[model samples]
Target: MIDIFLVPIALVVVLVMLHAWFGVGILKRGIIFTDLAIAQFAALGSAISLGYFHEEYFYILTLSFALLSAFLIAIASQREIKLEAFIGLLYVLGASGIMMVLSHSAEGMEHFKSLLASDILFTSPNDLYKSAIIYAFIALALWKILPKTKGFVRELLFFSLLALTVTSSVQLAGVLVVFVLLIAPAFVAISLELKKPLLYSFFFGWFFSIVAIIASYYFDLPTGYSIVFLGALLSSTIVLFSSKKNSAQN
Candidate 1:
């Protein structure tokens, strides 16, 4: 038997690491929608692949779609037009396309459920390890590139990191929870005003994730929702406390 709870817990950690690496870049570039956009695109990839291939193929296909979306978003961001509007457009198109594909091809509603909100109980240790490996390589690549690249090349690398992280997060945390994972730690890092933002971001991401995991197991709540809920609570508390501190200082 699989230790179902642990797998999602591990996945939550992987997602936090991913966001720490890429979320900072995406936020700096003013493309916060990148995570949500690619997550929908990932669902589209999985839906389309299910028509011809096994569900496992969704990972690679989703990765490809993520890269493609990132390139397009990068181009849009460089333009005068608002990228959020485009992101909104693409998000609906991707999600609707997936729904249509799944509806026509598959019989039951379970497939849609998986793509919409994943069941963490179904995740095995093997899946957690796989997610870890994927996140590790991508995180390593970003770490390696951040110092070496500069100018336009550096910008491009950040976009790539955003794409990779978004795709991997979609696979692990599904679309909804992934955005929380991307934003929570980044928000806390900013409010805390840490000297090394990236390192602090990673620390908080892991910290909140562990808390979320334990909460989920003990409460028997949905793992993804639990993670996001706890993260949101923590973030809110931090912001509230920070505001009080600022008021006192003033």
Candidate 2:
């Protein structure tokens, strides 16, 4: 039992650390759906590969679609128009595109379900190692490169690195899992106004995620969706109840 779970837990630890950082940035930007939209596009690329190309150029197509969305969002961030709406549209577009692309495949629905949230309980060690390597580079870029840059170039780099991260994570953990990991912990940290929000996010994310993994194993539930459900539920509950209520004074 311990051996089976160690790799997945390690994967989530790495994922939470990297994603919590990006989540802070996303909350500040007010474009909450950016990760989902990019992740959807990445999944669309994978769908295309699975449907037509039989999984050829999987990484290239996935990264291409993800980068395309990031590029568009970077350009849109510079504009005066509504940005979240644009991202929402991109999400629907990618989602619809995925369905259309996978329409003819025999395993279409299964593919769609997995794209939304993979069964990460059985994720292999090799997958974790590759993603860890990719995430290390991304973390370095976020810490060193992102702060020193300015203007559209900075925007592009940030989103590009996010895209790169999502490209691998979407494959490993699926889209909804990526979204929750990116948003849930950071949302909690921000909502509570923690001094060390990033550190808090890491702790909070790891707690819910590991618990979800354990719960899924015992309950025979889907691991990825379990994480998403528990994370969303806890984050929302905590934020709502812990919120300051209005009081009237005489």
Candidate 3:
């Protein structure tokens, strides 16, 4: 049992550390739905592969669609239009397109459900290793390259990296899990005005994710959805109560 859970736990740790960093940046930009939109597009690409190509070009299709959305979002970030709303539209378009693409497949519903949230409890060690390598490169870029960029180039690099992260994460975890992991911890840390929000975000994310993993193991629940549920619930609850307390004092 311990050996079986080792890879999954390591995956959770790597995911939290990488995602919490991006989550802070996303919240600061105020484009909260960016991950969801890009993730939806990634999912659309995966759906296309599953529906038509039998998942042959899964990574290429997923990254291509994710990069396309990131490119558009990067452009929108430079423009004066409603960015969040535009991202929302992109999300819905990708979502509807996925349903349409999968409509005729015999296992469409199963695929759709899995796309929303996969059972990460059984995640393979190979998958964990691949994701960790991908995330390490992304982390390096974020640390070394991203800070030097500016204006449109900066936005493009940021969103492109996000797309890359989401592309890998959505495949390993799922769209919802990716979104929650990318947002919830950062949301809480930012809301509470932590001095070291990134570090706290990592801590908060790991706490909930690891707890969710343990609970799922004992209860036989869906591991991905359990993480999503606990992360969202705990983060939101903490933020809300903290906000109310601050408001009452003021």
Candidate 4:
């Protein structure tokens, strides 16, 4: 049992660490659904791969679509229209496109479920290693190159990196897990007013995710849904109490 969980736990930790920082940026920017939109595009790419090519070159296809979405979003950020509405439209477009692609397949519903919530319990070591390598480069670029850039260049780099992260993450953990990990930790950290919110986000995310994994193991629940449920539960509770506290203080 311990051996069975080791790789999944490690993968969850890596994902939380990489996504929590991005969550902070997204929260600050007030574009909370940006990751979800980009992730949907990646999922659309995966669905296309499943329906057409039997998983051949899926990663490249996913990354390409994600990057294209990122570029378009970055460009749209400069336009007069509301950015959040535009992003929401992108999300719907990717999602409906996925359904259309999978409409005729016998395993369409199964593929849809997996795309939304993959079986993280069966993640391989090679996937973890590849994700770690990609995240390392993203972290390096964010820390070094991003600070030097300005305006549209900075926005493009940020969203491009986010798209890349989501492409790999959706394959390993699925779209719902990716969205939860990207948003919940950051949301809770900000709600609680932690001095080092990113660090707190990491701890909060890892703790809840591990507990969810363990609980799923014991209860025979779906690992991905377990993580999402526990994450939403805890984050919502925190936000509720925090808001009440602020209301009382005022």
- Candidate No. with top lDDT: 2
How many Å off is the CA of 169 in candidate 1?
2.7
lDDT of 2 at 152: 100
> What TM value does model 3 have?
0.97
Error (Å) of candidate 2 at residue 39 is 0.2
How big is the positional error of residue 250 in model 3, measured in Å on the Cα after superposition? 11
Choose 1 or 4, whichever is better by lDDT: 4
As for model 2, its CA RMSD to the true structure in angstroms is: 1.7
Worst window of 10 by summed lDDT in candidate 3: 241-250
What does the lDDT come to for candidate 1?
Answer: 0.72
List residue ranges in candidate 1 displaced over 4 A: 1-6, 51-56, 105-108, 240-250
How well does each candidate superpose onto the true structure, as a TM-score? 0.82, 0.97, 0.97, 0.96
Kindly list the per-residue Cα lDDT of model 2 for residues 20-102, writing each as its tens digit.
Answer: 99999999999999999999999999999999999999999999999999999999999998999999999999999999999
Instruction: List clash counts for every candidate, in order.
Output: 0, 0, 0, 0
lDDT of 1 at 136: 77
Query: Candidates ranked by lDDT, best first?
Result: 2, 3, 4, 1
Writing each residue's lDDT as its tens digit, candidate 3 over 1-250 gives 7886788889989999988888999999999999999999999999999999999999999999999999999999999999999999999999999999999999999999999999888999899988989998999999899999999999999999999999999998999999999999999999999999999998999999999998999998999999999999998889888885557667
Count: clashes, candidate 4: 0
